[model samples]
Target: MTTANFVDRPATAPIGEDLRGRVAFVTGGTRGIGAAISRSLAWQGATVAAGYGSHTAHAEQFRADLAGELQGHAECSVHQGNVGLPDDCRRTINEVIEQHGRLDILINNAGINIDKIVLKMSDDDWMKVLAVNLSGAFFLTQAALKHMVERGSGRIVYVSSLAGEIGNIGQANYASSKSGLFGLTKTVAREAAFQLERAGKLTDTGLGITVNTVTPGYVATEMLASVPEKVIDKVKSSIPLRRLGRPDEIARVVHFLASDASSYITGQVWGVNGGIDM
Candidate 1:
């Protein structure tokens, strides 16, 4: 092609094709799975903005790490906020969109684990888990849905756990919130599909937005790093891969889902577990 033609090429023309010109916001994206997602998106040509409650140091460090990988590829930044509050979620995501002019992807990855039995679990326990895990996602998605609905494009993924599906000991509240998110995904898909079908917008048929979930199993991170050695050994022994999953592994899936390649998928739960759970 001529030089002028090349200059006029599409955004993903020079680089690889994954998520070019898209903007994404990730919650609880500092150093673990969320950071991985942020980095992956940046590498794929998506301008990524990550939100964190505290630990500004960690968030900035992640930004620096991604900045190196996405040089001349894409852009990324970190925002500080609490994902559990509707106002906080609104402020964080809206500001990003207001600045970027659009938000094409959202990863509600912040979650908490308050392990306790149902009988012994206080109301606060139940509410706290739900607030951060389920309610937080709800709030962000709620605000972003307007943009996605209006633009007829968006991708949203919730970072869940196998415990959300199979139910683990001392995680009744957590499981409940994660499971509830599944319903939210399905419900949004159903509603958005109905609107598009009625309007006959075949081009935007994937719910005007693709909503999905990613369930990870036994990831080895600083959070899990605190566990006793024996417990870690036992957990790793049960994995078919004989090891815990890395952050980048999960980030890879997030990249695929955020990209156009996963357009046909929605309202489904994908497991990043090492072949242990379906």
Candidate 2:
């Protein structure tokens, strides 16, 4: 419920110093919500590695941005690749582990929104969303999981949207991918907590990772640049806050999920929509 100003000294991580020296991997972390999450993690003393799809120039710029914000410059790098591909997903994790030696947190935030009526949507439109939104997360998590299981501690969060929870006028593909995340969160948590233990492979702390998803509603970002005026008007009027969420607002919640304060929370999907759904 705290508002943000987006400059100057940042607040401490909600979990205090527990996240110090941790390593975090964030997909689609070059801009928008992803960038905000990365910046917050850096502010909390975690090393962050981000992935991008189509913005090499922005990726290059982040190296400089971190130098100013993080004080010592980020010992990080960005890879330009499609998250939908398994090879690229693996490469993203491998690169992070190779550079940082450990992977403690993973934020699956890479997604594409191709708004269209179900009748008008093409196969390409549907498949593209599934590839990056669903498949990318599956690939990256599977690749990074062995390390997590071996270490028995990790955090994973997905960036979903309000549309997925309560449908929208012209976003079937996007909605499907986001809704799928709720299932992924619960299923992954159940498997780790139950099935792994029955198989005699999980220790009390070995598989104690927390996986969650954050669903944000109508955040201001490049993706919203094309939203119809009428739709924007309708959303703002309906929202109890009477305004759209900023990227950092959503990122702050993500920072909590990646830190120890959320140690008791897992497999939960939190909506950061300014109480829009409630």
Cα lDDT of model 2 by residue, 197-248, tens digit: 6656556445367889999997877666667777777878999998888887
Question: Residue-wise lDDT of candidate 1 within 140-239, one digit each (tens)?
Answer: 9889877887777789998998888889888999998988888988887677556555656547445357888899887766677567888878887888
Give the lDDT of residue 19 in candidate 1. Answer: 81
TM-score, prediction 1: 0.89
Off by over 4 Å in 2: 1-18, 195-207, 226-231
User: How does candidate 2 fare on TM-score?
Assistant: 0.89
Error of 1 at 226 (Å): 1.6
Which residue pairs clash within candidate 2?
A: 152-206
Instruction: List TM-scores for all candidates, in order.
Output: 0.89, 0.89
**Candidate 1 positional error at 241, Å:** 2.2
